[model samples]
Target: MKINWGHLNHDSAVAVQSVLETEYNFRTTVTKLFLQKLTDEMHDHLEDVQFDICPLTKCFKISPATPEPVHAALKEIMSHHLPKYKEYTYQA
Candidate 1:
């Protein structure tokens, strides 16, 4: 079974995910990441770097202009965004 990890909007975002996967086994081989909109809010967070989707996405024909700033913004969110739900704790 393959599961989607949502969309990645920038090259740096792809690089970051690749690093995470190679270094941490963050996802199963069957997992996939999809790219969606690169909004202004998302772009504002990036420091200043241009980006594009990976060949895989392009080969499949998914391409877009994702500026560096948006990548940075995504990174910031990944760096500081809180978990939607808390981990479970056991009481003795």
Candidate 2:
């Protein structure tokens, strides 16, 4: 969540030493959020969406508190993009 939020607020002016990191785009994240399997209904993407009204009658939206799937997808993407395979010996 922190990483995603950082994407929304990227600051090249104050970067930490020598780290090679690019903030992921927020738009892509939104697209992924609504990606549904062929079996899923059109509204399945909205399963986690929460809406509410403030005291002033202004409408607002809140994302799901649980982002495990997003985190898992990130882990999967990182592993595939930057694989670290250990040396192995195969014995038959």
Candidate 3:
């Protein structure tokens, strides 16, 4: 899945990506917990999945090889942190 956060400035897009990556590591609370949930539930399917940010396009891309369930889980997880960009998300 690709989520175009083109509406955000370069710095803001980077910040959001940083937050997600950081949260995934720490697993503190809220976003962290959700990210952990996705990691735990989709471990198998997520092996080849990648999360990348394109500063030029201001887009966040998830590997297309990810299973549909993983995609849905990602959408739900991202929606919490990026509600404003929901409309910009779509399958790649």
lDDT per residue, candidate 1, 1-92, as tens digits? 11222244556977666644642332221121212333556434333332222223321111123345554444444334323211212111
lDDT of 3 by residue, 10-92 (tens): 46866778655653442233344354667665766645444544444434545455568876777677667666435534333
lDDT of 2: 0.31
List TM-scores for all candidates, in order.
0.22, 0.24, 0.43
The alpha-carbon lDDT assigned to residue 44 of candidate 2 equals 46
Model 2 over residues 13-84: C-alpha lDDT tens digits?
Answer: 444211222223332443354453212443443344322212121211222342445434433443443343
| Candidate 3 regions with alpha-carbon error over 4 angstroms | 1-35, 84-92
| Candidate ranking (lDDT, best to worst) | 3, 1, 2
Clash count, predicted structure 2: 0
- The lDDT per prediction is 0.32, 0.31, 0.51
Stretches > 4 Å off in candidate 2: 4-66, 84-92
Best by the TM-score measure: 3
The true-versus-predicted C-alpha distance at residue 12 of model 1, in Å, is: 30
